[model samples]
Target: AGDPAAGEGKVAACAACHGSDGNATAPIYPNLAGQNVAYLENALKAYRAGERGGGMSMMMTPQAQSLSDEDIADIAAYYGSLTP
Candidate 1:
């Protein structure tokens, strides 16, 4: 139960890599559009907790660290609502 409208307002930073609509700006970044909300939530949480490790983790970890639970939910909701 996240507010997609509220989530839209919080995605400015993510737009640089993930694009405003959740599609990635480059091939290196995975598109978040239309992803499962649970998956997005788990991934964000893992990144924030430093439990996810990989090439992307180095970048995502720092980005996710500043997000609150509500923020994560909202962001995930926003992305999940988009078309892939």
Candidate 2:
């Protein structure tokens, strides 16, 4: 919902896994590009809260747990701004 430019830096690490544009290089990683911002935000919060899980959750759970709400917003905005 905020300026997508502000989120660019916040997503550097994410680029390694999700690609700079949020399109994943592998099928194992879910593509984040062009997803709804609200959905991304909620999913991150759910992962952080340990309310979602499976084998794949291990990677996201710890990452999301360390993210602040602002980070979540920025990251969501960044990916949501991209073209899926």
Candidate 3:
């Protein structure tokens, strides 16, 4: 699994849109907080693979591309730990 503490430091880029606590800063951005880890991981992996398109795919794909599996897991953990 992943360590929330470790994930915290890796989410600086994500915070701009997703917020530090997994909430979205803008209504157009989806809230990541309180989402399941599996869903978060799968969605990010899909984005990285370019399997998911539309909406923010153009932006998300590039962001996810630089994340390793461990990074994904950690990020998922961090976001999952938050309350919606």
Candidate 4:
């Protein structure tokens, strides 16, 4: 199982734009609260691999690159557990 506790700190950087609870304050940023873990994992990996990001999304590439598989899973689990 993903460790939500660990993810809390791992996702702190994301909170700046995605919001502390995964609900982005900016409309341009997609709300990640209650998002699917598989989807989040894929997106994060894609962003890291430079296969799915463009424009503003590209900005996330560096952050995603810093994550390991475990971080992705944990962060995905944390955000997925929230209400959308």
Instruction: Note the Cα lDDT for every prediction shown.
Output: 0.93, 0.87, 0.95, 0.88
Q: List the residue pairs that clash in candidate 3.
A: none
The candidate scoring highest on TM-score is: 3
Error of 1 at 19 (Å): 0.4
Task: Please say which candidate is ahead in lDDT: 1 or 4.
Answer: 1
- Residue 47 of candidate 2: its Cα lDDT? 95
Displacement of residue 11 (Cα, Å) in model 4 is 1.0
Candidate 4 per-residue lDDT, tens place, 1-84, comes to 677778887988899899979999799888999998899999999998888756667679999999999999999999988898
List model 3 lDDT by residue over 1-84, tens digit each.
988889999999999999999889999998988899999999999999999999999999999999999999999999999899
Q: Residue 84 in model 4: shift from native, Å?
A: 1.3
* Global fold similarity of model 3 (TM-score): 0.97
Q: Candidate 1 has which clashing residue pairs, if any?
A: none
Score candidate 4 by TM-score against the native: 0.92
- How well does candidate 2 score on lDDT at residue 51? 92
Predict model 2's lDDT versus the native.
0.87
In order of appearance, the predictions have TM-scores of 0.96, 0.90, 0.97, 0.92
Ranking of models by lDDT: 3, 1, 4, 2
TM-score of 2: 0.90
Alpha-carbon shift of residue 38 in model 3 (angstroms)? 0.5
